[model samples]
Target: MCTYESSSCQTGETVVIGENNPVGSGNKGKRFCPQLVGTSESFFIPVNIPSSFSLVARNIPTDQTKIRSFDCILRINEAEAGVQSTFFNESYILCESKEYMYADDLLQNNVSVSVQWNGQHYIDDPTDTYVTLYKCSVNGGSCSRCLSPEATPSFLNCGWCGTECNVIESDVCQSNRFVNQNETNLCSAPAITDVRLSHNYFF
Candidate 1:
């Protein structure tokens, strides 16, 4: 059995001696080297608004000197968060999102954390950790703002009917609704009140 304090170990060594008491070299056997092991705790610190928060990782293992740095990756739901900042540290890492991440960015109000060595190297900690964030309502925005392409977190899924926001597949916004999911020119058509009919007609 190996303990936490044990760095290395060897097992199953055999030694054979000749009849004249001549000692022969013994087999070194299999040796086990020390492995990186640690636990990570993460949390979200609200920086500016409910949609903006800084990711903080703590209590990471820093016993290995060969590990140059740790890469803290932020995952929204199950996909990679398209933040511009790259967080790096020796024991822990702190990263702030460049773009705003709204409540719609998360599936369950939680963001996943994946800590790696350097860039692509994996660590001994296989378990994934998550940090919970404040859930802000995505509804109640103007039709133009809801359907605008410049909106942060492109997955906002805002509907252009009476300023409502929801998943693209939701039936909340029914008539005169334009979802901001995929289709383009959704808000190009003028509203019913914007059309003015001319009285004079010539054939």
Candidate 2:
């Protein structure tokens, strides 16, 4: 069993969402529990792509007694772009662990987070673990999964729509002598004024 966030939660905010008795085997939770270490990763929609944001945890054991590898997958509109693992195949952990991933090199706005550990067992139940999630937003920009009617569409490779101007950089847009109906690039495609100015020379 694993815990995942349904929506964005701020970093450093803690919530207790699970509980069970350790002594009672009938329906009692595991006698031993590992606490969740606090660490968080954040992501933003690309400054030019179209996508949705999500945080996910997979392969996590609900029992808490057993130690095994777990994976965290970050998705953009459910599209896979990045993945990270915890308690790798070679290692195991008796307690919940924390893992972190920084911004950069994201694909489809996908990110994976994982952890590695050495495992052993101990008995003492009545404990809880929490998964904390945070979202990264630009100083004055908002994130979106699609472009507005006035905004230009992003390159196919982009993951989320962000605060930067973009053009379909194909040969058609580059040629001053040719006007291609299929190609269109705009200087004010982004929602932010500064971003539009930053790319002003390109237009």
Candidate 3:
């Protein structure tokens, strides 16, 4: 009497793919240690910056990849801005149009930005202009923008353009209202001394 034990009895059945080739050799391959990372932070390095240099802020659309063209008037130590405006010769943003950069590194040192945000350039006017002063380390790595002491920071201005008046006849820049963010102020441009770069975290 042939008796099949339920604990260890099974008819050997070969599971096979009915489609494809009837018979063939098989080989496999793969890769290991795949590397991945994301590094984006703007940097401003000062090695041998031209005494006079100019760059466009290249505002990118916050919602999409569109570019905004605006002039950045930069100056150093209460100096004239246009004097250095001619030296500008580079594109800061990746997008040809106003497209928001993924990270600050996209704009940092890659773009030539004067450290100082001196308000002498724009004629001071509380009602018409808004000024926003940004502080940065000499190394051009760390930066603090908008001098909001409590509700309102110091030295920095916004919502009202910028400083509404200049030093009477300082002649640092043309008499103008600070409407555009690309507009530059008399800042210790390009080659600023150790003392020139403000490390102040607050006003």
Candidate numbers sorted by lDDT from highest down: 1, 2, 3
Residues 130-168, model 3: lDDT tens digits: 111222212122111211223223222221123322211
Worst 10 residues of 2 by lDDT: 121-130
TM-scores, each model vs. reference: 0.33, 0.21, 0.15
Better of 2 and 3 by lDDT: 2
Poorest stretch of ten by lDDT in candidate 3: 28-37
Give residue 90's lDDT in candidate 1 (0 to 100): 36
Candidate with more favorable, higher TM-score: 2 or 3: 2
lDDT of each: 0.43, 0.30, 0.24
lDDT of each residue in 1-203, candidate 2, tens digit only: 22234134344322223345233233123322332232363343343323333233222244434444333333334442333242322213222233333344332233332232222222121222222222222211322322332232333322122242222332222442321223234223444445333544752
Candidate 1 on 1-203: residue-level lDDT in tens? 22222224224222223334444333222212111223454354321232323333333434444445655455764667533224433333545444335446332266665556546543333345665543213433554555555652444344555345543333455554645645546645545767677998889
